[model samples]
Target chain A: MELNKDQATMSENNKPQDPDPRFACEGCSVLLDVNDGDRLVFARLSGGAILKIGNKNYSLKPMIGAPFGSLFQVESGDEGSFLSRILPVKQENKSNNVIDDSRDNRELVDNNEAQNLTGEEIEAMRREGAKGDEIIEALIANSKTFEKKFQLSQEKYLLKKQKKYAPKVLLRRPFARSICEAYFKKYPERIGFLRVDALSLLLTMANVTAYSDVLVVDMVGGLVTGAVAERLGGTGYVCNTYKGNSPSSVEMVRMFNFSDKVIKRIVQSSINELSSAKTVSPEENNQQERVCNAEININEPSTSDIVEETSVTAEAMVVDIVAPESKIIKAPKAGAKASKEAIEMWQENGFSSLIMAAQDQDPWSLAKDVLPLLSCSAPFAIYHQYLQPLATCMHNLQQGKMAINLQITEPWLREYQVLPSRTHPHMQMSSFGGYVLSGIRISTT
Target chain B: MLPTESKKAVSFKRYIEDGDLVIVYERHDVMKPVVVSEGDVLQNRFGVYKHSDWIGKPLGTKVFSNKGKFVYLLAPTPELWTLVLSHRTQILYIADISFVVMYLEVVPGCIVLESGTGSGSLSTSFARAVAPTGHVYSFDFHEQRAASAREDFEKTGISNLVTVEVRDIQGQGFPEKLSGLADSVFLDLPQPWLAVPSAAKMLKEDGVLCSFSPCIEQVQRTCEVLRSDFIEIRTFEVLLRTYEVKEVKVDTGNMIGESHDDYNGGLRPCKRKHRSKEDGAVSLDSSSNATSVVMARPCSEARGHTGYLTFARLQCLS
Candidate 1:
């Protein structure tokens, strides 16, 4: 983990040298001379020939596997430190100049003069007629020196090898799909509509829940929403509306009317059951708060009293329902009357329910009209709007002492694919941008 | 002083020389002339080729062009035969082919295996590498690509060391076919991961294996499949860009002159005229009268981005 001064210096010096000479031999200072058919006993590194000795030069051959420093012995002298001698030295025969005739017709020379032979020498003799004890004796004489050098070479080789082939591992954070899958598996019911902006909030919420599933209605872009849903094994439905191009007030009323019809078909029966429950006294604020501990409203309601108020009205006519600092001018308009009658009819049938208003629409007026018809019914209302208005409405509703709690779910921009060719031809490119809101009602029993 | 623009006038000139056209003919089985005359046109189901058009042009150029339609004129480059060579299987892309040639560490006289030869694209590259002394034993399961590949080799005049054979590598490994005698082996197949074991048998000790796969899943599978047989597996990708050339001027003064022209020309000239009238003399040359064309440089956009590449070295037990 740490480097010493000398080791660091050596490491710095080991940077790659230019014009790398190939096949450098460890055995000899003189490059092997192979062209003269001298039958070199030791193997030379291929292409290792860099210097010439006497009158001959040798090219390094691949056969010599030793490092450059091992083959040649360096001896310091008065002149300089030069290669004194090559290992497994050969003493050339100076006496045998003439051929001799014998039964084998081979010239005989003294073999005793041959010094310690190298691996290269042994291989060369094998190629020639020299065999048996002669080769064995040459190897035996050189074994000690060879072993010493080989061990040193091997230690250095292994250190270099480790530096080259060390195992490397890198870690990265998992993608969105992986995160969603991990959280959704824990609390499956909490996952709601899939949209990009909603998913971003959901991801943040997952962190808050310690990766527990919590309810989410994503109003983000379609593709990202779909991908998130797929990761969670849930369904995603895109709401078709451009948030920037909102409908007129008249159109808004029609949409609210349609929503009322939808609520009748979906939650009317449940509303009746909750309305028929034995009415508790309005003095149970503290006890009710204890029951809905985890259901703390994100916004302050306008109502001052935190107790339930009951009033049953006989007429299906319009009435002004007043709250603290706010008034419901058209209390029982056509759509409002229908919604109120639907809630009352459900209360007559006995069902528990919750009503969630669509984005950009008022939920208080509907709540006020319906509450008068079913005062014994505990109705929960939820709506989404810009932060300031929503917070103000919540404060007024809380001050007025209405039996309603407001939770602020942030508005999210949803992306939809628009046909560039058909709309906005000047900007002939498809892009996504639009905001929508969604809120959930939690029934307090 | 700035050097004057150098201009040289070129004159259109043509020269004609007399030469003899030697034509060699070979007898076909049906008695048709195999080698057509210099003036004769060779006709096939696809198109017609004028023998005369090819006589004067160098190799690799399209021999015939009628109307505006023309096929690529090609010189007899190694790549031409490599492209047109017959194959019993899928061919390697040019990107993978170039990479393998560099990775195998091949040199002249190396004995190479064009194994599992799908389409013979890699085989032709191998043949070109080992040419003059080296040889390529291309093996394939399909007979059609092999026969056509052999014909292509003959046409390219590179019959040396390129032996095409029909052999199924999966049923019986290439070791029996090659007899453990090749220096290098290149495997390009759908299941090269499966063929690695067989390639091990054919490759020499310290030999390399270059596998080409398009998908990451295939690469991962191949790596897992090759783990026991090879080591030092590395992945790489290459991108190629061809640039268009255009002349550009680096002078900033030209831009400054254009911007300041109206103010300097109108105001400075009028002021100078008033001063000249006061001095009772008129001058012709003025800074406001100067005008020059600022030439814009032409340039071409670079083309092409070749896909990813992965490589692994074979580690043999000594």
Candidate 2:
């Protein structure tokens, strides 16, 4: 409750909410939940060192009790004494550091058959200076039915105890791969299910590497931007574009904690500004847009008469898309003659790849406007949670014969709880890895 | 626009230059990497393509042949090289190659080892992934195959990035000198279990490893051995399905010689659901005989399953 008050005020600033990843040590921000097998999720821990997971707050690094992932309850003021210990966090993140090849499979028994000690007795044993593994082994060895539980169940019991008493949360040397997985797992709907596997495919397919320029329009947060920036290894440029008041996606990019040298490579512009010409006043901005559309249509090879007919139908469709509320949001009320210069600056520079994953915009119109800007034969990938929008965009772009090897695919993944003589796929895993529509932009001319 | 003109940062040309090896991509099913020697003629069904025409152009150059047939001369990035290379044995495609590169966390300065080079398709990709600073040591039991793969690497200008050796990795294991310095190890051989122990020995503590296998049984055997000294064991089957989308205009009843209602009137509910009003005009005329709008659809065929990639990290002894 004390930390919750701090968050409400901190929300106003644009700085990243979590500072844990920025530090090599444990947090003054962002407390991550360390589960069995080192699986991690966001469980905010900040001021007062309070960690609340579903109404239960576990005081971590608590001197008197166990550790962060340790299962224990504490009152508001009661936590101060334990937190003062402030033991330094464990630095290494090797999940398999505790190699347990000695455990054996067991048969199941009734709950009554298993013996357990009271919490006070366990606490007494801790006061006697028993380390994590010793206490855990002692508990297991003392359990009357330790040899009676099924193999999987026995493994589960050990994992639960391990997580509850582990000395600390999993400290990580955060990289793009780890950060993407952490954030996506925390907020899947917000990040648009851009799984690490699928994101990797996008990076590889777009050929994003060192010393290259990539145009990125991602609404799935800055997962793409961060991933691309890291791949370049502090070289090349990423043209980052956004639509809202500020880039909502930049939130994720900031989490990557990249150096200023790498961050400098990112050039940012607004979608409204990039789609229109610069040096065009409020009066001419709309006209400049119309002219830009017409200029691009010149490559369509359609007759003038046909274009006029198409223009009318396209206008109707555009109007249909604009709800009364969104119309106001979409309006170009701000004068943009200055931005015309900005738009020209980008047009002069070439992009090796185009990547997009936005939920709010029509992918067809967005892709058509941008695909031509891609250097000829460069790759472009548009990711969407639903396939209908990408299919529509592919249909529109195919009319010009400007792309080949257009593909929509989702990589399938299975996690196996690999153990000696007991390896099998996890009971339930993700079947949907999201979908990616990728292709190479080509020019017949 | 600012104060004194800032010196423009002069840079070297990174794009395709003359006398470079680039893959000429004709289509998804057809591609070949060629040495860009000026005046060389590439005769194909599209026409006789002159190499001089492609000089000074960027990679992914969409150029025409003598008779005006078209092809894209793409930079021989390992992914493109994998597609266009002539196969000497069963090869890995871009799907598996990309997954392996990412899962293994291959970065600059990371030393990677691969066994049974096979056609050197995947080795090429791995080399490009860990280039300039990192190295890829690939071992093949067959001496002839190893020699041929080494030649391919030299031609592609990545001989320095990857070193090919003739050795039976599964039978004899990776060389003893490479004991524990590798950042990652990859196996593409039969009976990868036979080499898993050696791979474990070569890795730095917590080093990553990946194995490509077509059969579940092979993956199972590999996993059984990896369990003793590995964590985060997972498998992936990456598939790429290409769809060709094109719009077909249907008469809404008035465009063609027939009435617009005549088309929708005869259609059942299922067929009616497929038709939508033309969002854009189809032609110079107000409308064609087709009263319907063109919509995209998947082509008759699609590329299917490639192979599975299994990844694990060597356990750090405590």
**Candidate closest to the true structure, highest lDDT:** 2
The interface root-mean-square deviation of each model, in the order shown, is: 36.6, 8.5
lDDT of 2 by residue, A112-198 (tens): 756587678876776665555577798898897767665556777887776554433433334566666665665577668877777
lDDT of candidate 1 at residue B152, scale 0 to 100: 61
Best by DockQ: 2
DockQ score for model 1, please? 0.01
The clash count of every prediction, one per candidate, is: 64, 20
The TM-score of candidate 2's chain A against the true chain A comes to 0.66
CA shift of B305, model 2, Å: 5.1
- Calculate DockQ per candidate and list them: 0.01, 0.16
| Stretches of model 1 off by over 4 angstroms after superposition | A1-63, A66-445, B1-39, B42-49, B53-74, B82-90, B247-309
lDDT of 2 at A175: 54
Candidate 2 lDDT over residue span B146-246, tens digit each? 99999888887778788999999889999999999898899998899899989989987657899888777788778777777775577766665444333
Report lDDT (CA) for all predictions. 0.34, 0.61
Model 2 TM-score, all chains together? 0.71
